[model samples]
Target: MSSSSHLIIKNGTVITSSHQKKTDILIVDDKIAKIGNFTSDDDDAGIIDASGLLIFPGGVDAHTHMELPVMGIHSSDTFATGTKAALYGGTTTIIDFANQSRMESLNQTLDKWFLKAEGHVYTDYALHLSVTVVNHQTIAELEGIIKHRGVSSFKTFMAYKTMMITDDEIATLMRETSKYGGLVTVHAEDGELIESIIENNISQKNIAPQFHPINRPIVAESNAISRLVNISERENLPIYVVHLSSAEGLNCALNKSNAKIILETCPQYLLLDDSKYLHTDPLEVNKFVMSPPIRPLQNHQHLWKGIADGHIKVVATDHCPFTLEQKKLGLNDFTKVPNGIPGVEHRLEILFSEGYLKGQITLNQLVQVWSTNPARIFGLHPRKGDIVVGADADLVLFDPNIKHTISSKTHHMNVDYSAYEGLDVVGKCQGVMLRGKVAIDCDGVLKINEGYGHYIHRGACVV
Candidate 1:
């Protein structure tokens, strides 16, 4: 009935955000028209034969930092390159952070990020503003940011002495966000504890990349997480714990002692451990210098168990990439290392290979954590994370049989190295669609639809 093209996918297992079933899907233009059975009688319909593939809603990475500036260096990937890699890796939508400092206005910051993304993105995108300073003026801007600017969630840092806001300020922000129905997502780490440790390490001349994780120990993360969780619990608001990296933090999120809070862990924490910091080569150690840095090998089991038991809600890449040259800024001082790694492109594959295929999580849990939960928590659901009728035709036909080695040599991220280098993973996105258009196929090629993505405004947090 519309002018857009139609397509049909046959003989595939359709995995929705909620469940997985063997079903056929019919697409009309950018929306899924019908799902279940498709006779495929229309000669003009584009048909994809997915005889041995798993269909799922394309991944939604809710935390990424594209073209963001931090510590005097901009993250290597821009919207253009980041989204391209995200698409090739089967993510059709990314929610990148729009950061603002106390010196800047929120409205102006949103405008600046919008200008940076407009006509340069390859897949749909949303934004969550990181509020560096919370005050009367900044709190007043929340209405405009949430309603006019279409950003329904805000992030606050609990670490980074120069950037951290007071607990009172965060409490006020959380209260205001609750009033406006927006979610408060946080990077939780005790700033005072980490700073003191860093000072001690510096005084002792223990200034190597390996010392990076020691300064910010598990307690730093757990103490901060407990504080924020308490605030969220008292305010009766849902707070998202971003890049949760330790057993203590995980326990705080699970609220085994008190209240429950939403949790997100990166693949790096799930798969890698702190031993990488002790690498013989300090430069190699610098590769994993992300905040809430990878934890002890023992914590990996706790995180996996949390995910398995449904205590951890989402898995996001907090993807902020920096090149070796940029990372070397801290060669003499471990504190100077830009704290991030390249991960947007490998999040799904690694999670699939290590989680679902490895029998650690069920298929439904995979869909929930990687796609549905992110959308649901950030308000992008029903549009970005489901394979149901009337939803955008953003989907992936994954070949569970395909095996590939992850390495910097073959990855598309605009970085010199891969944090997941040499990791072997089964299952690949053999085919993909964005809003009903064939974006990538079995050949793993993008159809050159540059700037095809549009800015999507998400609603308030549902969970």
Candidate 2:
């Protein structure tokens, strides 16, 4: 058989958001042409015998920041490195935040991000505007971006008072987003509580990275989550809580009426703990200095429960990365360090080995929480997630039998360390295709083509 136009993935267990069936899938020109015992009539076909593998919609990471400028430093991964890491981990699409600095125009910022990602991205991408300074001008521009620029989501932060919005700003932005039919993504954390604690910690001469976990404790997170939920509910606005890390925050999400709120947590929040910060060398703790910091081991258990029961609708890699040098900029002052971890390359394996295979969550649940729900919530559903006909053929042929330990040596993100370093993960991505092009195989990122990823135009929030 000549191997050219069509590709057949034979005898794999095809898993979708809600169902898993043993089947073969035929791909033609980048769409799932046929499924369920599919056969190709064409002779020019390349086939992959996927008998023992698990096939899933490539992951859609809703919250990531690549080459993002933060606190006098840039994120470690450029759009190219970050998205390439995402492909290795089975994620085919990422909705990165288009950060609007307090002094910059949203238009300028969006354009800057587009230029940064133009020919570098290895996977499909979309933007969610982060409203750092919410005002009339910013508010008025939200709908225009949604209608014309294909940006359908907005993010507001409640924690970094100097760089974020106030309650009044949140209300205004949420109301405006509702008008534009866009989703509001909030970085929920009580600014007052956390700031006060940090001030006290600094005053007490406790200036260490480990103190960061103690300073911005779970109460701060819980307090913010509850307040955001209450405010959005009273205004009849729908909101999404990003990087939910504590039981209290999880409760605020789970206790709320489903019509009003959505919650998402990241792998760092689910796998690592405050213990990672207790190293004898204080600098070592800096690796875990993400905002809404990692919580107690019990919170990990709580988050798993949230995922299993469907209280949390999305699992994403908050892939904001910084090199060790950048991370050490605050060697003596923990507050000066950037807040994020690199997890794009380990999202699927950690979830599968720990969540699904352990029976904490089903395989379908894994597909939904990691890939399908994120795509739907972020307005990239039909095109980015799912194995349906006419959708982009961004697929992952995942081998459940592969045993690997995640580390900086084997990982692909442009970071000096892996938070999941040395941890054994059972399942790994064996092959990845982004929009019908082989971006990653056993060899790694292929230069089959440059600029293969298409910039996705997303739909306005259905809510």
Candidate 3:
């Protein structure tokens, strides 16, 4: 489909982080030109009747890994497939991670990610540099990465042996990145404890998929979060904790640290429990083998309360997917299984159904965590999130009453299995507008093509 210069969406309830109003939106080229009740005399303007639909700012998923190499295999979704699925789910912008290998410099890592994403993604994308090693030269690159490269956040892992760094290294990173207004985001799980437990589990013949969660207990998550919280407090540096899974971990993150601690949780933690590991079929259980694995059922309420109480800041899918064939690599040993699940396509719908429909959070808060909060935190605000005039016209026309069952057969992700299969969800994305163009029409037809997405050069964290 060709891009139209003028498009008007009429009679939709526009929902933002602040308010919701029945309004009309006018788009000229790539910006929202006007909003309110209005009529246009331009006959060439495309008109979309959005009666009874809820218009939302397209979601900004702050954490996603498309085509990432992990555990000797790459994630199933490429930039093109993953972002296309994201757009179908009303997420128009994703801040994916560009992981640095221990051997390569940070610049080389960024260049490699650019090669993977540029002209390949279907939605606007930004990147967070994942720091695997910290040296004098690595520390020196912080200023350029933050100030010049437009990457405002650096990702650190406290878990995986290859990706994890020492506490001293993390402190140095926090101190150095903060000097240039760059925020440090972390996967907070105790690597030493996890490794020790894995050794013990393997020695005792507890190598099944069910033992995956047993190997990395809740204490590991809580302990790491507590350590990071203490460091942030002592150093007066802000930190973002990604994919928080347990109640104990949430408590640690909320432990009154003087530094800013932004919390994030995923739908799996909110809805699914570790009981999934107990399924008789090993293949079925393998689908739940993500790191900082799904926690006990009791943790769900605590996570929901955190979101409702305004403690949790973002809801992002750590969308690294491995096919079942790849999962079989660990059929006998759980540690060989690639960690992560396909979730980019269902984040918005699942959040809307379970969060807003269940009254766990308000619509505004849903919009906040799902779209506005991530954009603001990742420095894509005003341009990526919100429905205000002059903002990029990335919008979703949602039918809140539309109910559907989630299954791998219908999902647009490249993976073979769905982490949320068979779950009934409300609020489907009926139409999507990206940069003043109708990317997904009211009938759910994809009007846009691959390579239409642009790279977003982000700024420092705003919240």
Candidate 4:
């Protein structure tokens, strides 16, 4: 019932990216001390009989936005609540964005985010500096940010008017950051084309939620991806594409270029479709109103194939949630709605039930994409992703036979609605441990305090 300085997890099937084995894990303090069967000499060591369960490395969600300000209001979840929800869902670490304002420096942005998360989180977290403006000062700060500030990735938006930088600026940032061992990530979507479409739709009085996807068509996404691929080839830099939605966009990303393009997709794009936009109730339709809206049902096959064939590297939820009352701000006008949905707590279960149980991907592949790849890509490798000796003892004890339906009533995210409301899923996190401490017990009860999480200083990207 209480955390011990020494702990042993026995008789569980340990699932790794390469193999699965029935092993016993010994934890001393905050790290894995041993991985083979052994008896403890310490009399006070806590022991857990994990028979018939699967022990996995805790999830590393590489993309999330907690307390993000967009439109006219901030997101529903703060660091305190969002990280707790993530812990309950089996994710132990999340890489959140610290967006830079046009006038503020990168350090200033990071400081603000630190003030928000330092003593208020329940799971370990890191920050990715988002670049809204590319200037001489920004370029000069890259070295200090990467070398001293512990941030190794820079996120750039190719869509939003306030966040989008020019093609030249993106190239310059790639060139500048690569010098300091930093990776450049992008939110790929053609802004000008989408803006024009939105203007036309508004003039025609087609401002409903259905028109949201129409305004940002498939071509817009594919075109932006193509341009980014071309730039990556020309600049000879690796680029990460966030939330690839349509098959056309996937094809563009697969264009025969020498550049390495890492792809990440969310659960909504793989499981849900655009049909939700046509719901009879306008309030219900607004719930699916995220940017690069869900694609048609047919595109799901292509994305799953991408995962199976090893084209996509990671699967992360771009978790940004807004309450229904806030969604009403754009009830009649789709452009005014906050663009996000909550799925931080359902990623692992949905992936296991839909992808692994259905034979779309193996359990190793699920663990690879959901945990290992994200940690390696975001520079939190052996310490946060694997179950090897000397690694941090962040783990999940899962019951593979448990079947349950996901609903907003039982979820933990601060938002009121669930993106995957009625979907049935297999595999549940019965218990979770963070740094050898009992954070979630077998009964799914939270057992940690706020401020239990520490800020992780990451290294260079390995993938």
Q: What is the C-alpha lDDT of each candidate?
A: 0.87, 0.84, 0.91, 0.91
Q: Write the per-residue lDDT of candidate 4 for residues 155-269, one digit (tens) a residue.
A: 9998988889988898999889888788999999999999898889889999887688888888999998999888989998888999889899989899965967889998888
Best by lDDT: 3
C-alpha root-mean-square deviation, each candidate: 1.4, 1.9, 1.8, 1.8
Total clashing residue pairs per candidate?
Answer: 0, 1, 0, 0
Cα displacement (Å) at residue 447, model 4: 1.0
Q: How do the residues 1-463 of candidate 3 rate in per-residue lDDT, one tens digit apiece?
A: 4356888999999999989999999999999999999999888888999999999999999999999998778999999999999999999999999999999999999999999999998899999999999998898888998888899999999998889998778889989987877888999999999999998988998898889988889999999999998888888888899999988998988887485789999988999998899998888889999988998899999999899998998999999999999988888789788889999999989889999999999999999999999999888888988999889999999999998999999999998999988999988999998998888888889998898999998887875
Candidate 2: misplaced stretches above 4 Å?
1-4, 442-447
**lDDT (Cα, tens digit) per residue for candidate 2, span 342-425:** 898888999999888888899999998889898888778788789898888888989998888889998888998888889987
Clashes, model 1: 0
lDDT of 2: 0.84
On lDDT, who's better, 1 or 4?
4
